[model samples]
Target: MKFGEISESEYNEFEKNHPLGIFLQTVNQYHVLNERNWDAKLVALRNDNNQIIAAAVLGSRKLHIGRLYEVTGGPVMNYNDQAVVKTFADEMAKFCRQHGGLILRWIPNLHQAKFDDHGNVLETMNQAAKNNLELAEFQYNEPQKVENGHYSKVALSYEFIKRLNGLNAATLEKSYSKDAQYSVKKAKEFGVTIRKIPYAELEEFHKYTTATAERRGFKDKPLDYYQKSFKAFKDDDKFLFAELDLKQYVILQENEVKTLADRRQQLVEKSEQHLSKHRAAQARELEDQIQHHKKRIVRANKLITRFGQKPVLAGSMFSVQPQEITYLFSFMNDEFRDFFGPYLIQDYMMKLAVERHIPQYNFYGVAGDFSGQDGVLRFKQSFIGNTYEVLGTYTRVVKPITYRFVRLLKRIIGH
Candidate 1:
């Protein structure tokens, strides 16, 4: 197996073709990391057929001790194929040895590795056993949780194939949990309107997103971040967080949705008695079927409410990808929140996903270990999608002393 660095485009292509592509391996994440995290490299491993079978997208930086090589949600490989995975690991080890105390951290693309308390992480202890490389203690933790190396990546999923099918407003309202359904109902009275702000409306998108971030104690991305992201993802409008003029459009849609859901529920209860009654074996199946019908009704109603809002709203960027729609950012006035503007906007977004065929919506990194009492996690869990735990941070230390000294200094500095 031959290993060498490749370009971002090549890795991105590989990422798309590879079934195990995680968000961090995507071109978007790579570029973001390279721009902000560290210097980067693409380690490509090819088979005799010259097919690139195993690849890792990593970022490296020179440290006082030696160097730091951190893989960003990568090392896309066939873990079942021991030879190839070993080759990849050996090469990584060589890089570490060459750099002196190499820290090769990774977030693997598959469910192959075993992690203890902190979800999937690059296990320093088991590296040798799994890939025939020597080991070190695994230190997998984030800024807030890494007291003695604790980390977690929040990734959620639903019964993807079945649950996300309510691909539009009709399906979304149908699939929502009762509280979620109630949240939908609550949004309307507040006069919330959910709609994509289009690429042209990025300024506005950043507004809501920044507000959301600041509230959560995260530094919001600069305006340029969204601008660059939009330029790169113009084709995928589904990922963008849309704006809802609460008094203008979102509330109206929610009200209309609330009305439709009520009607459908009434129909469903009435049909419950007349419909399939194979009471025991067919219970779940029948419930799903009834829910699907009601959802279709709600969707039809949302369509009717949107007709009057052509020139009524502004613009925003959108990501059309089906399974994962991440709102890069959003912003809104806290003053207007009395309308529960955010929920109104969220309801509209779920409806949009249903309508546009985007199933999985990502609210991104929710302190997976429950680091603190963050209300946002609750908000995200209230949606149609279930929470997922992503592979946590992995680093193969190139310069152990450098890390050690840094650790010492951090400790001394009261970090």
Candidate 2:
């Protein structure tokens, strides 16, 4: 188990053959970020059998009020040996310390990752606990955690696949929640097609997604970010996409087939009543209203059917160590909200998971308690995936002076 830091390309080769196939393990992330935050990237490599066996992306010089060195996602590794991990751990500090005069800071990818067993997280936690350190507690806008800290969230991945054939509207309701299930039903019946949007069109996907995030009041990365992110790891298809037939949007309560049916009846009755009532606006309004009601029931049915633009569902997912797969962002049209297009897209993604027997479908990060987030949390929880508490950041001190100086500076600057 010889050890030494290596270059990004050298590391990527090791990553390809390692048991953990992860995009974050690539050197490209550090390289690209270096363009913007140049000082924040470092690479470490080690080999076995004269082949690159372990490599790490050591991001450094984190700008904070106090001393900060930020390392994330992780070191590329084949962590089968305790001696290897221990050696890498020590080298990690030395590698990061080389970049700055401040405290040597590190948070392994495993530490940042939340999972079902929490095995890796705990392992890293125990390792960190070995250091002379003060544990962190969560607070508001001000970070209760600091640089050199680690955190993670555990939730069911949208990548989950339960069963496709027997997947009735009820099953969808059971998996996602009543509203989500209903939306899927609505999408199908309204002539909204459910199909995969290809990776080639990912640019378009980002555009709509950015617009959606803005309208929804959240931050979104620039298209270049996605482009670079994809380029950095496209070799493995870690970043994947699927689009909804905007025409096929739906929304309903989980296990609410009857409710959707009832809504459909109401829409039909309303349309019939307004049929002889002629006015372009009125006719269009009624047509829209009817479609809205019908979309839920229709999409509920589509929940069981599969249509995607990707060559295969498995291709849409990428990972290291077969860990969790989380959704970064998703999109759909408001004009077709009545058709439940987004829900349809989600169900299709899940069906792909079920068919391919993928393990998890991470909903990414969800706020624990925010008034506006009720719907989002509900949607995530509806999937029957285990929800673990999101960990707050915990920091370690490498340089006392720099740490305090940064903190005081932030206070002076009012950060």
How would you encode candidate 1's per-residue C-alpha lDDT over 243-317 as one tens digit per residue? 344234444545555665565566567665664454332445445655654554464346446532322222223
Writing each residue's lDDT as its tens digit, candidate 2 over 238-349 gives 4444334322333333224455456546655777555453544554665565565566546545543543211111112232223334455666555345545556556666
- TM-score computed on alpha carbons, candidate 1: 0.61
Judge candidate 1 at residue 141 and give its lDDT.
45
For each candidate, give its TM-score against the true structure.
Answer: 0.61, 0.58
- Candidate 2 — what's its lDDT? 0.48
Candidate 2, residue 20: lDDT: 46
Per-residue error (Å), model 1, residue 220: 2.6
Candidate that would win on TM-score: 1
